[model samples]
Target chain A: MSFFDRFFGKEKKKSAGVAKDRLMIAIAADRENSRIPNLDQMRAEIISVLEKYISIDEIEISKERKGDMDMLEIEVVVKSTG
Target chain B: MGIVFAVISGKGGVGKTTTSANLAIGTAMEGKKTVVVDFDIGQRNLDMILGLENRVVYDITHIMDGEANLSQALIKDKKNENLYFLAASQTKDKSVLERDKVKHLIDDLKENFDYIFLDSPAGIEGGFEHTIHYADNVIVVVNPEVSSIRDADRVIGLVDAKSHKAKAGETVGKFLLINRIDPELIEKNEMIATDDILDILSVTLLGKVPEDKRVIDASNTGKPVILHKESEAGKAYRRISKRLCGEDVPFEDVENAPSKGIMGKIKGLFK
Candidate 1:
């Protein structure tokens, strides 16, 4: 694109980037597994897995018991700079 | 900048606040200017532990909200002139601890204190994140139990993933302070072993505190056990403090303390 077009186009893209983006992740472990992963470890793993695609701005984690299995629900908001 | 340490645990009642109080006083006793902040928010216990509860006119929220300055809010320790205390707000608003505000407060404290100890809340939610966000080192408090060890492991992971040092691609030194260890229970193979806990957590073992009844009495009186020279738990904390200052102190023989009576001998047989 021309210099003038490129300069003016940046503002439009910046506004679009300001829009919020959210990512929800869930991990579960059942009694069949000898060892269940800790919530913090799973959180780091989730961030590393998502790091290849986007940067994380904030994270929220909670636990839910489902039958015989335990689950970790992670909600991460991607960094706007990405 | 001064070192910022967060005394944290995964579960509640694992002695995180107690450790923070003792360690801060321990460091201050060694001639380092120290300040311990109660980051438990609605559940303020550090003030009581340090026996400075009555002196708290303002809290962390007051300072963060500009209602009070850092010096104005800080309570000087009655015994140790070098030690200071910052009480947590009793307000139910747990969300008052914003990341930037927390960092600003810590940075301001670092300018004046040699060691800043953050007494983190029980869970890894709400105030817990902000408490460890600026930590240069973390003291993971655990008990010789399965649940406590598992929770401490989780906390260790969070320290690596969430701290400012971690975000900046730097490492935050992690150490474990195993507390509330019952020697009799361990001799009976009932409680988890110290070696097993260290192996599971994979963090440097700072020290082990024997489960002493004196700790309870000290807490009840709003005094740190470290002040009681006769208490084993108090002595262990003093040694831990010295170790933190890079002193070469020998670890306590918690595993092999001499048996007391017939029941103790029976417990030893199970070992």
Candidate 2:
């Protein structure tokens, strides 16, 4: 709700959920049958956005497909500044 | 044998029993008399997952060993009148289950239930085969990651070769359910993208579940995700259930569950 709330990490749970939800749908929608061009688009967009802000550390992409549906888990922890 | 459907995974922790338990509940909720038999003998977590641990006395092993009858061993959900459960023996070795005995047991169950859901063990060998051998369809549970996907791919092959349908010169109708997706990580290229999994597994995707902590809470509380209104996993599972019943339904976007908000949280919180 406020700067204090952000600094204290109270809103972290809620906001993290919101942000994760938005990011997942965008990636899923972009994926063609969850195949290739979509993943390439997702990777490019993520890399560009991260380069704009936090210093990139490492990026690993993994995926799982069920029948005709797809699910992805993305773990991103930024590199610390000195 | 009864129309068996095994909810399997190559690796553990991708929600195999979770899916099987809920699908049992969901199938019963739809008025189909269903029984979810926990075949993960010795592990015995299915009862906890279904919230029926305390009531299980006459387990499947008791019936298989001729110590108890099928009806005597089956535990009714009590909450859903149409649902029943047969727990695995907590003390017996998994070797207690023989292929012929299992076939006979499942055959008796098939005569009684419209759907027989088997919560299979993690591997393809031993009890997993005996459990999977009677299935009409197989739902492969996989998380969107390297280890999980690779294992699921292997398990899919195993199911194809090991299923009863395979013996009849037909492959089991395999469907994939990808679980524990995180949208934020995908946006950062930190996690696997949906596309990569499909490229490797090469199976038809049934549905995708978002990484929702509500699932853990629900599982802990002994309720399935489908029971929660606000759960992305719950809602996704409901959609998957409908698809299994041949109903037309759209899949949930794995990334859009959080903003949809409060309702999912409240639903889980109340449960």
Candidate 3:
């Protein structure tokens, strides 16, 4: 910490700390998502198959890591057709 | 058999070529026969860094296409007899580098040298894959910054999933070298601390090179910084080279090291 910052009481968080926090989150997401190939295409295929039966409002696809295995997760919110 | 090290950085201008040149020369000076190959293809610059541009008569592509023999393509270092270089073809298409050909070249290099350093191209496509595909080990060069660290993390994943050893159920050795460290910036909280970077990447620390003007000067003169024994960057590379050979070397405190810049001198007064 600089002398002025220490005396005046620093209010803002350090950029280095902010960078570290951002990197942690970004790297974790990259590790999980980057490993799975054609993720966007796979998500589209799943949405198409689901839309055939249900009125899909929203669909989210993500890859979650459990131990040495990767679990493909697909979450869909269905809409109520009147 | 020779150990192959791919000097890789996912981002450009992060000093992979510089590290490759220094490590090759440093190891060669240790009496180990070392060969540094430029895998950047059309953008080849390792020759310029090693001051071997004029000595290159045949390049790796020339050998791969059966136009020139390995013995002919390998340029013996003028300064260090133990050090050799294989320049990349300046005009060849990057896609022309076939997997089998690269494997053949690496296998040939393994037979002849004790150490083979492949200066990899930046990014994770085309030539980049070919560079790391045959590496027995990797030196991931990164600067203490957000983008560089993030890109290095992504490349680390590929190194594990793509390498020949990884496919063969063996693990490729991974090491991290953080370059261009400025103590003043770290003190001012403008730069990421070395330990923080190490924690994020989770790769074994090789050595931290101080941000030294001598590095740029050395490159401009086509001499690798490792030759300048007085320079801090040179000293850091020397220690890293020792570590590469399994020698126990203590890490110097880069953070507390007395700064030589004008800003550093100004900051020194406050301390």
Candidate 4:
């Protein structure tokens, strides 16, 4: 383990002999709205927000409907340098 | 191996199921062995649209669960000799579609048929992902409306991000099928034009289906609209099928089409 990894307690664990860094964010639209927002614009906005924290390698957005509200679930895979 | 196409739309009621049924029947009419699998789960409607509801004994779940073999679950179309259908389970929940099971079933089907059409459920739920995961091609259906176009853009993104072809660093061919277009509405500037939709979705235009009442009538009567030779929608689907088969069929001039009147009716009868 590296000095930074041990001090910060950010331990990288391997599952099935492979390592991965995955981030997921769920954004729900306002229930009062009659329709969902434009997904393309939302995706761009979300990526801008995520860029401040991590270097994203790829992003995937999937739509979902729960009861009357619509949701956009975003998944981001961060770049690994090690 | 066969080409697997997923007829998907992010929004519901935009003619995804209707397009799937007609395309399956159209390709079968071209003498290719085709099978369309419904992935809608509990809200199964593809069989109803194909007029094969009464013929469905075993469904996709039964085959995936090993309770029935492929031959036992496959329902040959009553009208088209080369066409077959595998209905979605009405009793099982959408979660029953595990990734491995879906991949196995689709792989097996690809070995036996020339084309496999997966009728994806509306929205980007589990049912939709399961259908698109194994697709080699994708047909995104949309009506000429703002909401429908936006949702279709979302689906186009998913096809790139979620499909096995996409994950393998291979491109899954994507096409846009615009359905229920009304010429009068277009002239009145009430509906979005085909060019605008194509630009927004940024996919090749496969075909457009006109708003023909015969579509609904065919659905109600348990017949695919493609069987109605005189209907404009039927002709459009036939053109789409030929286009899918690598033919260069030209798009119909929707704006120049004869108005629906006695003269048009007479012309249609002759056609």
Candidate 5:
């Protein structure tokens, strides 16, 4: 406001928006494509492993994704005790 | 754990109400008791979304004004037994709610429900301040367009300023929900992708809901798409609900994903 007022008769500040497409894209990938395997995948893997025996109740497992040190984990309750 | 989330957008019709309505239903479908309260006083469509339009005899405004108790205003869901609705007032008056009264009402609801979802009024007006003042968490909905993202940023700032946690020098647990994303448009490099939106907001990516016809149909019937069991948006909302419950949900690669906008878009348009 000071410089504009002195030089150009009170010209207002017009903010030229910084295009954030590049930054937003990376953040979205990190979030949506979280490399850390999630719980749903873990549940599917657990079910496949338990296929020989029986269904199980909420299995608790946690794992971290490799990239950007992100992590994804889930807990699922299966009906059977097997 | 009882979670309180207020869904807000700087602008209206970007699905704040839709997301609030469906997110609550999705959470209930996951076996959590959930309720969505309308704070968008004059324009109340959440009841219509939950198909409780014909059932509401009271609203949060009533509780705020001491005209009704919270229990009396809590409407049972027509579909999900665990879901509930608190309709907004049809009157344009925003003076009915006092800040402390709204907070007290929310604290009381927390004692009974696992989650309380508030559908905020469009933009950061007077009502927007009250909507975010007591939020334990906030989900800012954006449509992947410039105007929407710009408004989302403004609301995110307001959220940081007014949140109870923020007042104690902590920021609200802010997340971004991008709705009506079209994979085909992203493949054509015409629309902003998940990454693009995330980069701008610098927030935790909740989920990206693809544009689908089922969404319109679900709203028409006052039933959430998550109840459908097979629709794409329903699947996304279910995942979003689960993620909100602190479940580990995997991300499915959208058909038009791997969208790199800046480097590519700049080159294509200029070169």
Candidate 6:
């Protein structure tokens, strides 16, 4: 944080580091939706149906290709009601 | 088949045209028959960058429309016998390029040249897909900024999903070329590091060019920076061109890359 440290190039954190972290999160999110059209709409529909019976914590939709087949995998984490 | 390398970036002004010109010239200097095609259309700058603007008799559209033959449209570089150029039509927009026509042009060029460099325009729309459609390899140029990196990732994804190779259940070669790397900015925590970009993109590191002022000067003179032996960016481009030819050229540690010429040595003494 001091001028001495900056001059010696011993700063613990850099904006570039922060940028890398931010891009990782942003690009991953973008890639997830890029594969499927109307991904958010699809998620909303699924949530509306699921909310009728159960509480959902988080929903993750990922797509992967194996050979000539496309596999769309969904992971739904349920909210615990202890 | 000849290798088609597309110098593409979804964001504009990240040095795609500069890289295309330099790499094409560099490979030609290495004695490989090279042709650089301007696919920018309506905003063509490759001819100006190569200093061959006055000599363009016909362009890519002329060849495709049967108005001119390939030899008539193709302009051989006056300085380099192995290098040639194809100008993009200034009057036509990106929509003028169709898939089949682009394929025919590429196929014809493949029969003559060892390397074909496509200087792609900015944005992911219109003729952008055609540029990467038949690309054997793509050099994704990024400027170490958030918007540039984000747009480049989008283009990378498109290359995977849209390219002819990708459509045929094959993968097109993807390489990362991080441009305008300012070490002083990195030291001041202002710019992204080369390794950080490589880690984020998860692509092979083709080369990293240090930010240089001479690049603009080279552009102004219609000479690619690669021809300047004293320029750091030029040296980096030459190294990248060699790597494209399957040569094992080691990358320079751009953060600590030594400055060339006398003034650089004096500046180093202070550091």
Worst 10 residues of 6 chain B by lDDT: B257-266
Q: For candidate 3, write residues A1-82 as lDDT tens digits.
A: 5554555687687898899999999998887676678665787898889889888998877777777887888789899777
- Chain A TM per candidate, in order of listing: 0.43, 0.40, 0.56, 0.46, 0.32, 0.57
> How would you encode candidate 2's per-residue C-alpha lDDT over A41-73 as one tens digit per residue?
787789889889887776756566767767676
State which candidate, 4 or 5, has the greater DockQ: 5
The Cα RMSD across the true interface for model 6 is: 5.5
Name the candidate that leads on lDDT.
3
- Clashing residue pairs, candidate 3? none
Which ranges in model 2 have alpha carbons more than 4 Å from their true place? A1-82, B257-271
**lDDT (tens digit, per residue) of candidate 4 on B94-129:** 978889989999999999999899999999998899
Give DockQ for candidates 1 onward, in order. 0.02, 0.02, 0.33, 0.02, 0.05, 0.29
Across A8-82, the per-residue lDDT of candidate 6 in tens digits comes to 786687677788889999989778656798676899999999999999999988787666777888899999999
Tell me the TM-score of candidate 2's A chain. Answer: 0.40
Per-candidate TM-score against the hidden true structure: 0.77, 0.71, 0.82, 0.74, 0.73, 0.80
Residue-level lDDT of model 6, residues B1-271, one tens digit each, is 7889888997999999999999999999999999999998998899999999999999988877789999989999999999999999888877678789899999999999999999998988766788889999899999989999999998998887678887798879999999999877876567988878878888898999899999999989998899999999999999988988889999966777353557556545665
Among all windows of ten consecutive residues in candidate 1 chain B, which has the lowest summed lDDT?
A: B262-271
Cα lDDT of model 1 by residue, B1-271, tens digit: 7899988898899999889999999999999999999998998888888888899999999977889999899999888999999999887578788888899999999999999999999979888898788999998999876567666766776676688788799989899999998887776455777776775667999999999999899999988999999999999999999998889999987766565568556544654
Predicted structure with the largest DockQ when compared to the true one: 3
User: Which 10 consecutive positions of candidate 5 chain A have the poorest summed lDDT?
Assistant: A10-19
**Candidate 5 lDDT score relative to the true structure:** 0.78
Q: How big is the positional error of residue B230 in model 3, measured in Å on the Cα after superposition?
A: 1.1
TM-score of chain B as predicted in candidate 4: 0.93
Error at B153, model 2, angstroms: 1.2
Off by over 4 Å in 4: A1-82, B257-271
For all candidates in order, state the fraction of native interface contacts they contain: 0.00, 0.00, 0.70, 0.00, 0.10, 0.68
